[model samples]
Target: MTAPGRIGIDMVPFTRVRALLGGGLLAGRMLSADERRLLLDGDEPDVPGIAGRLAAKEAVFKLFHATGETVPWQGIEILRAESGAPWVRLSGRAAALARGAGIGSVSVSITHDEPCAVAVALTAPDSEERSAP
Candidate 1:
């Protein structure tokens, strides 16, 4: 069996995200092109969706445990599978952090309500760890 993985959860208020996204720069900095497309393709009133994505990113960031490092927001790309499930793609420093932490695949789940959004991230142990039995 695989080793138990790390879990991270975060919640974000829609209004807060809305204000950040209003400047547009934060959205560009935080989201990948595909993620931005997904946000735009979503239904009207995009604040909740943005908040959901932001929360997902924050949740994934927590899994890294990079205490003194700056959050590589763009490196942790949160995307959707064909089945509409949330998946994580790590790159750059985020990938390095995951490797350092023995994190393999990262999965995320996001939900939105009127006022806020919440997300949870789970990081699977690396293959070597899984094979260590």
Candidate 2:
């Protein structure tokens, strides 16, 4: 079982996100379809939004605590709630890594200021871990 209170945080600059969007490749590689729709469907470039999502993804990846594995960038989805709050959904390698790490759920918070976006992720113990005999 893993220890309690596992947390991860990351920060991303809006300028970097803008550069990635301008490059076009990293944006496609990093963002999920739904995220793309919400962030990229707009007329103007959503630099802060993209930066927040990137920060969120990096933050989520840190929770896995796995070494020698590449971060499954697109496999970590950051979705918005009806209230416009951000949430996390993991798939593929990200989900498997979380399971192996004894993580059940991850809660994320994102905020953006003038130049950068910041995100923090907190993990809950897995059901099996909590219920283990």
Candidate 3:
């Protein structure tokens, strides 16, 4: 059995993220291809959504950091489910670090309101608890 779950939370301001988007470089540096596509494809202005996703990613990084792992900003991907729920998908060194830390699942919740976006991340050990007999 591994350690118990860990939680991380983060918040970002929409105005700050909007300025970053205006510059055109921060989005490319921080978001993955799929994430960029999702943001751009939305009907609403992309600032809030992008800010929420960025907060979610930062929350995930905090989770990893609490576990003593360092992952790049680009290594964490936050995606929306068909039902519009958010989830996390790690890649490259992030995946390896998560595996080594015995973190089998990472769940994220995001919310946005006029000026700010907030996210909470939960990281749990492998699924053995469900399979225990």
TM-score for each predicted model, relative to the true structure: 0.84, 0.90, 0.83
Model 2 deviation from native, Cα RMSD in Å: 4.4
What are the root-mean-square deviations of the candidates from the true structure over C-alphas? 4.6, 4.4, 4.3
TM-score of 2: 0.90
lDDT per residue as tens, model 1, 1-133: 3226689999999888777767876556887777778776556537777788889988988987879987788888877777777778888999898777767777789999989999998877555322211
List candidate 2 stretches off by more than 4 Å. Answer: 1-3, 125-133
Candidate 3: tens digits of C-alpha lDDT, residues 34-127: 7888897667548888889989988887766545454466778888777788777788887766666667778889999989999998876566
For candidate 2, the clash count comes to 0
lDDT of 3: 0.77
Candidate 2 per-residue C-alpha lDDT over 58-84 given as tens digits, one digit per residue, 9 for 90 to 100: 999999898899979899989888778
Q: What Cα-based lDDT does every candidate model obtain?
A: 0.78, 0.85, 0.77
Most lDDT-accurate candidate: 2
**Candidate 1 structure, TM-score to reference:** 0.84
